[model samples]
Target: MADLSIDFCGIKSPNPFWLASAPPTDKAYNVVRAFEAGWGGVVWKTLGEDPPAVNVSSRYSAHYGKNREVIGFNNIELITDRSLEINLREITQVKKDWPDRAMIVSLMLPCEEAPWAAILPLVEATGADGIELNFGCPHGMPERGMGAAVGQVPEYVQMVTAWCKKHTRLPVIVKLTPNITDVRHPARAALAGGADAVSLINTVNSITHLDLDRMVAYPIVGEASTHGGYCGSAVKPIALNMVAEIARDPMTASLPISGIGGIGNWRDAAEFIALGAGCVQVCTAAMLHGFRIVEEMKDGLSRWMDTQGYADIAAFSRKAVRNTTDWKYLDMNYQVIAHIDQDKCIKCGKCYVACEDTSHQAIARAVDEAGTRRFEVIREECVGCNLCEITCPVDSCITMVPQESGKPYMNWTQDPRNPRAEPAPAAAVVEQAGA
Candidate 1:
């Protein structure tokens, strides 16, 4: 059995799975139910100073797949609409009641020292584990000088982080927005501002789809629609890249990360952890399938960990960072050619068509003695691009098989084709050129 426990920037949880600061954690009722359903922690929905944020009806719109599964979720919803006092009181009671579960309060306010300074003490008084500066929300709050409005600007990210660090005794985790051209700038800014950790990535700015009849985007309000924050499985690849960038960067390598975006299963969570997330947060998955999904997540992760010989999360945490590198550093000599399994091949010409028309002409089609259609890999022409494998409908029908080239490992920098390749011994250069 593997232990899923994690100590994220001093806030301990039984497992690495936590509910993100979204509708799922909006109130004590929702949070309590999540905890009861086996969540290890919850970031209370973004809270603001009193006269709370007003939300609109029909605030959510989802992008669905062919089977009607949510591929992505978009929202124009704002932060918590409950009063600050009520939120604080509830946070206090919930933290006291569930001392074992992590209680990190997410807060957003006008970018000012006064507002931040005032709210820090009130939230700290709730006995919460920590405070996550909600600088990542992309919709309703940004217009008010909060959320991505502040996060997109490195200066604001640093200043607000400094203010929160100055006023609060709790660990300040800066929630970063992904809207910026470069995510590292804001992450570095957070570290400079004395942030304890950073969580990302906030929802992307997107309008899922437009209603052709009404000529308006989704989540239509009357006859108008504005771009909202986009999340869910579709954004996982983007999120993973960002997390890997931060984890491998020299500037913020030591910073703790709470991974958010498109995490629905144990594999997704494991990928984030391997890329250096201290914990993983879930929102869209919970909304789509309910909190009980965490049970599957926990069980699947634990079982997989056992098979991998990992005793705890830390055992595999950030394990992939070393392997994540620039394209220039990749071994040019390493090669793998596609192999077609005749037994498993479904005789589908999708792979053949895809490779012949769009990619390298690496697959040959013919008829066998029985006049049955057959497809085989043209290994000599295969560039090891994996296009055939990806297009194949049957699993494992096309597998990439590594060849025994017996060639020395060489990166682009050392390759002879590179005009600025590093100088090598005459013999070595000749050998490489011949190879």
Candidate 2:
């Protein structure tokens, strides 16, 4: 078996899986149960200053699939609703109970150094391992001149991170906000401010649905509603791109990254690690299913590593970054064309309609004798771009097959693979050679 253990910014975990700060990690009771279920560590739900913060009712809304299950989630919930003293006590207890697990406290308060200075010692005295500055909460804390308020301005990000570094002996990880235009700007700020690691990305603004009768937004509790942060499996690609941006940037490339947003299972975690995240964070998956999902995540990741011959997490960490260069560095010679199997076709004509109306108009359709819709690929007119394959609903109904002989090479006219190659009507060369 390959080892899934990871040492991220001096904090070691049995695996690279850590629960993001959300409802699941709200207290010690929930975290202890999660640790037992195979979660490696947890960033406790963001704790606020004394007296704590309050949230609203029907605070969460969901976007559903055909099955009517939640695919995307929106939340107006703020920081820890519990008092500081109770949270500090629970952190102390949870750390003492699970010494092997990473207990990193998440905190959000007023953007003053004095507030940070006051809270750091209290959290440290609880025997917690480290602290993650919650500068990424997009919804609640911004009104108070915190969370993304501190995140959007690079100077504030650097200043708050530096304050945490000065006040606490624990490792400081600056959690980044994705609401900005460039992810690298705040990432560079964190590294400059002496942060040991950085985690991303807090959710983006969203409005899931609207009520027709009342003409109000979804989960309508009153006369009005505000946009909440959007998250789930749908946002993973966006998160992956942002993570790669920071990892590939020369200024902040070496700093450890904690990948957050839309991580659902082991494969998602591995992809994040490959893209240069030191560890992975989960929130929506746990919220959608339960803590038991962690068991499958850990098992699945370990099994994949064994099959790949990776001895440990470090062996494959940041492996994908090497191949993720800018667009100009990509291989221009790669080419492909679309293919459709007549025998396997259900004759839906969906591909033809989509292509003709919205795409390249490369697919032609006609009704056969059996009154079934059939689609044909136009050889000369086809651009071979594969847009039809993407829009097609049927499985294995459309495929993109590369053609090597019938066209001019768009990116590479000549290659070592086919030196002294003659142009197309390539079939003529074959016939002449046979004679």
The numbered model that scores best in TM-score is 1
List pairs with backbone clashes in candidate 1.
Answer: none
Candidate 1: TM-score?
0.96
In the range 1-435, model 2's lDDT, one tens digit per residue, is 988888899998888899999999998889999999989999999988878898878788888988887778888888999999999999999889888898899999887889999999999999888899988888878999988898899999899999999999999989998889999999999989999999998888788998778898865667877888888987788899999999888898899999998999899999999999989999999988988998889899999999999999889888988767664223345566788988878777778888888778888887879887778888777777788888777778789887676543322223345465334443443333222
Least accurate 10 contiguous residues by lDDT in model 1: 426-435
C-alpha positional error of residue 21 in candidate 1 after TM-score superposition, expressed in Å: 0.3
Q: Give per-residue lDDT, candidate 1, residue 2.
A: 100
For model 2, the stretches where C-alpha displacement exceeds 4 angstroms are 405-435
C-alpha lDDT of candidate 2 relative to the true structure: 0.86
Each prediction's number of clashing residue pairs: 0, 0
